[model samples]
Target: MAALFSKMLTKTDIESCLCIRASPLGQLPFEEGQRVNMHVHDESGQEWIFSCSIEEDENVGRFVSVGWLEFARFKEILT
Candidate 1:
């Protein structure tokens, strides 16, 4: 069974994406390059759902990065 792995933020890319680290127990059930849907909650308790691809695996020492699309207006302002 595939499990939902929660991660801690290790770094942030210039594009506003997150590079997260894994758990001390072990590697996640996900495979490298596997794209999966994820959910995140903001401070106000609203849940946001999105899809992202896995960028790392067990060999990478518990670090994984998530790349996602930025909102059109946000991308324009950042550029």
Candidate 2:
């Protein structure tokens, strides 16, 4: 026999957008032209992953661009 359950999802509280500053120099170990998988959690607690570029930089720990998943999160914060 199969069973089903009904659950109520609560509305999530909006979180303040976080402003992150990239390191002056690339301190993280990632090569230019490389990409990293970004994990993002929505207000509803749902999570997603996306790839982002590591743009050319001399710094070791530099953030080139925000991933697609993060872009969505940012958009939500704006609305």
Best by lDDT: 1
Residue 3 error for model 1, in Å?
A: 17
lDDT score of residue 53 within candidate 1: 51
TM-score to true structure, per model: 0.47, 0.42
Per-residue error at 39 for model 1, in Å? 0.9
lDDT of 2 by residue, 2-78 (tens): 32222232222123222122454336456657867767665677777766555543543544454453554556643
Tens digit of per-residue lDDT, candidate 1, span 1-79: 3445545434344356655655543666676678677676645776666565546455665555555435323335334
**In model 1, which range of ten residues has the least summed lDDT?**
69-78
Clashes of each: 0, 8
TM-score (C-alpha) between model 1 and the true structure: 0.47
Clashing pairs in 1: none
